[model samples]
Target: MTANKGLVATAGTELDRLAELYGGALTYEAAVAGGIPIIRTINEGLAPDRIRRVSGILNGTSNYILTAIDQEGLSFDAALKEAQAKGFAEANPIKDVIGIDAAYKLIILTKLIFHRTLSLAQLAPTGIDHLSPRLFAAAKEWGLKIKLLASTWESRGQLNYQVAPVALNPSHPLYQVDGVTNAVVIDSDLVGTSTYLGPGAGGKATANSVLADLASLSRGEQLTGSSACLRIENGRPLTKQRYLVVNPTGLPTGLQFSDRHATSALTPALTPTDLQRLRATNPGLETLALGE
Candidate 1:
């Protein structure tokens, strides 16, 4: 409900206070990212046994910054200042920059998805502050873009949650989201994968989403499906196939690979670790996967 310096702490305390006063008939949702309305759907209707992964883009400020940097060639500082000037960022901007804003939203989302309460401390938070213009340039060269993504996945009783910038290949649906828009992709056992995309941080857009939810409630309908609460046994960890560009100068000695396709493409046998090492050493190397 509130996102001051200690946004997560404030949210936790407020939820507890309201739970006591309202006998757990409490719901909390906020327009933190662009105009996205992330509702805290915690109540008896929740079923802990049915959820698998909760993931989404939870910050409109970062999204806008990245979009501007990629599309308009704006420097990070310039983009951020532009966002602040346009009322997209707060004067302080630490919450959005440090990912505390997204972390708070994830905390609420995870609680609702898992049908259990989790403190903000349980989730690890990362941010896009470390991203440099070099990375953006590299992304452009690699035919990709960078975006800050926040997600939580549970498998075999282990939960992984992080907020960080990621390089999305041209094929990933997320790569297409430009400007201040936001999207959430939820994968579950019953329904497989479902994606919701729209504006993440506008007053009017947020009010529209809230009104839609209210209309559904008035009709005695649920925004989530009946299988929303279903649970599944944690399975294998999800792995993504990624692409990497490397400078031939920094490549380790004796790594044998020929220029099969335009000097940039390598054989598919290269491992992710190898690519990571190459990325670390190569100053201007870029990489991008073909598609999602």
Candidate 2:
């Protein structure tokens, strides 16, 4: 099971059952971040500690596009084209830019860390295609960088996930990660916080991860599986955060702008539900969550 296909980790895949019946190790080291052994690390190294959160820039293509747009002042389409030219992105990079790629990786992490499985439809990730040059300019002025972040955490004892482009301040660990690099920030009760950084793409890097898994099997080490009871709830978490709204044609009725301008504003703390409602009502509105 060296393949990185996301379907293997989805709900009802019965991956654990198949592995058990076959007496084989279920290794998916390259399934998440290309070169980051995140699955193994969480399964073994940090098993004792309770993981509080798993967050990262999991998709290299999306990260590269965002970095190019921010650093070189390239438009979204131009940055994506450049990424394709550099082999950082595919000719059809819809999954990467649309956040579905990261969502798949997040699904795997959620299962490994929290013993939970979620479908792609349940994740419903938000993409980076809507971002404009003005958003990048505003982020730079605010001393922040925008990254397509995939994050999952337990909020009030329930798991909450978000895969979207977020404006992160300088202090964040994943803030400086750029180009085709991947970074995973794991925060646990014992370790407090640990960041793993590496090349996210390229055949060599991905192959190395696959080889590592094969080597583990040769050493008679088998990947573990959990039989924990599954739990699920719909919709994005209700946790509130400030948002950067750009070039809004119409604002949601109750949504207040802290910046005092209609063209652009840093919105007051709002929840995902609020944003969804706003989007449903307001067309041509662009927004990015302000990372804490």
Candidate 3:
């Protein structure tokens, strides 16, 4: 059976069942970013030791809404409604906007990459619902954009995973992705960093992707094998260097200024730990920070 479905676990399970019941091969390819053709290249013989990072923008609805809000100055609600009216969003948008959709996709990608199955229940899922208009304004002030990023990778021997919104600088490739496009950057030891970008939503496009996969299967083409196996090492903790804007009148003493963005104002580089401490002290005022 050939089916072009989205990143819904039900679809995956059903396909597996059908493949088992009929004793025939079940193939899928059109389920990811709209029309992009991504074959599930899983080679059991390949080692996982060579992998580095798996990062990508996995949802089209959130990506579109973010781009509209940032570039067009549309309110989040307005953008969301527009997406719904245009059929870019599901009637029940919670799954798409809240990272459930991305979580499922990540699970599939991880299994294919590592030749090990994983469950969506094991992932740490965070959505973009917490983002505020003020945050968007702050991002604009710093010439950055916010995107919902879902990633899972194995390094050293530990697995790291997250689905959340991140503020990306203009220099990042994700910044260039706008509207309903989806892009993924795979960083590996052999392949420094390879990026794939294309339409990430829409039914017709998704159908095309699935059909392309079926065509390949018909031609007897095989999916690429997994990477070479390696020892999993503990990944280093991430420390962000950020721009913090705080009103000097309210801030406590002992906070050293990293640099001044303007004559009267200062932009201090603060770590997440430092920001947490500052917020704990003063929770009533506004603070701005930038990180890459």
Total clashes in model 1, counting residue pairs 3 or more apart in sequence or in different chains? 14
Better of 2 and 3 by TM-score: 2
Clash statistics: count for each candidate: 14, 0, 12
Worst 10 residues of 2 by lDDT: 226-235
Give candidate 2 misplaced runs (Cα > 4 Å). 225-230, 248-262, 272-284
lDDT measured at residue 182 in model 2 versus the true structure, 0 to 100: 95
Tens-digit per-residue lDDT, 177-202, candidate 2: 99989999988888999999998877
lDDT, candidate 1, 1-292, per-residue tens: 2332244334654665675686443333444343444452222223333556766777888888888888899888999999999998889888787787887777666555654445555555667776656556656776777777777777556655666677776776677887778887767665567666778766677666566546555665433222233233222124544453444444333345453223344324345566666667656655433333
TM-score of each: 0.71, 0.88, 0.77
Give a tens-digit lDDT track for model 3, residues 54-159. 7789899999889889988999889999989988787779987888888777766665565444555566567776677766776676677888887767655556
Ranking by lDDT: 2, 3, 1
Q: Top lDDT: which candidate number? A: 2
lDDT: the better of candidates 1 and 2? 2
lDDT of each: 0.60, 0.80, 0.64
Report the poorest 10 consecutive residues by lDDT, candidate 3.
Answer: 40-49
